[model samples]
Target: MNFTFEVLPEERIECLRESCNKLMAFQKSVASIRPELFDTMNFETRLLPSMEKAIHNYTVVVKNNDEIIGYVYSNISPKDTYSNEFATFFDVTSVNKPYVGCLSQFYIKEGFRKYRIGSRLFSMSLDWLKEFDEIEDIFIFVSNGNSNALEFYKRKGFNISHDILDGFITVLRN
Candidate 1:
């Protein structure tokens, strides 16, 4: 299957809706594997809004035959106001530090996993964050159970910063 990777079209409602659907599906998939890592709230009421907000903030999605098969939500912002499931899991505290980029949400459809789509999405996000010179580093939290993701990030040069709850917070310097 052919896959196209690009920034999400936040200006288009249709695109946003597609992204929301993909996120919900991704959430469900994760919940099955690690229920504790996902919220028990409704997708429409809780998760969708957060996904929409991140799309508006900064995000990328991969499409196969015009269907959203993968996505990576990220942002370059101050650590204080940037909140996401991963960040919140760590209960990140506000600190007097420069702005940093975050790989907040990332998902790739099951069947598409072997195609390197997630890596492509991550590389794209890193390139986008590089546009902001103030972003000196990028952070991502991977669940300890998700060994594949941890290995992938490590292969990409991200170092494990520390253990956070049930996961490890990793970082990559730009």
Candidate 2:
């Protein structure tokens, strides 16, 4: 259960093979809870595409005994997609600005969920945003039905900035 966190460079993870396994793990995890979202996501989905594009800009990895246990892919988005949908239901009232670090993908293996790997990965994202020197804000999304994830973000001090009904997008301001 013990592990360490490492920030993987962009070049080290540009290829599909390097992070594909974890992507598959992430896909399975999302499918287990929200198949709809999972179905909409593929290798060509927004998360990976955006992550791949931002590889040179931002990326973070969680390592357990030198193995990648989880990762959070992020970049900027002018319009918060999720907000246009469920934000009203969650009573999200935050305003979206340009170039916000959009949290594209996040996942932790089943066995490693409780080991602070997720937190470490998230912290790495926050640290990157803080020092990037070009970003405006950081944003992320969570499925509405995924109570565990919602609660986890809440516990981590991430408030519901807005919700996207079409998919449920939650943003944490840092």
Candidate 3:
């Protein structure tokens, strides 16, 4: 199988929409197994919008044969008042800094797992974040139950900061 890893392009708006729907589906599937940990409704209404915003120049996707199989959405900017959900996942106030970047949403289709697609997408986003000198560190939240995700981030040098809303937010300093 051939795969391409790159920043999500503006011309591929449909890919963005499809990725969001796939992510929501993935979350809902997880919710079926651990309903208390995953909220499909909140993901659709709240997290989806944030991921959409992050798509602007900050998102990376892995495609196989021109089909998007995974993505990592991220953003960097001066800290400001954010949604309660955002605060719930990250220690926003503790940042106490001018600017920060966030790895907001990351997903790879079930069949595509263990293929290093996610790792390539994440590394691409980290490389993009490095271009911004103002960003102090990058933040990512992983479901406490998702041991695979937690281990992946840990392997990539992310440290657990604290628990939030049934998940542990991790940080990777730039």
Q: Considering every candidate listed, which one attains the maximal TM-score?
A: 3
Flag regions of model 3 displaced more than 4 Å: 31-48, 51-56, 81-87, 166-174
Q: Give the Å error, residue 9, model 2.
A: 2.5
> Whole-model lDDT for model 2 versus the true structure?
0.58
Q: Which stretches of candidate 2 lie over 4 Å from their true place?
A: 14-34, 52-56, 77-97, 171-174
Superposition TM-score, candidate 2 onto the true structure: 0.68
Q: Which residue ranges in model 1 land beyond 4 Å of their true spot? A: 13-34, 41-56, 82-96, 166-174
Q: In what order do the candidates fall by TM-score, top score first?
A: 3, 1, 2
What is the Å distance of residue 155 in model 3 from its true position?
Answer: 0.6
Q: Model 1, 1-174: lDDT tens per residue?
A: 878777755454245455555555555454434444444434354334544444225677788988878778776556544455445532345333556677766778778899878878888887887777665666776644466777888888888766644433333332
TM-scores of all candidate predictions against the true structure: 0.70, 0.68, 0.77
Worst 10 residues of 3 by lDDT: 165-174
CA lDDT scores, all candidates in order: 0.61, 0.58, 0.66
- Order of quality (lDDT): 3, 1, 2
* Candidate scoring better on lDDT of 1 and 3: 3
Clashing pairs in 3: none
- lDDT of model number 3: 0.66
Please report the candidate that would top lDDT against the real structure: 3
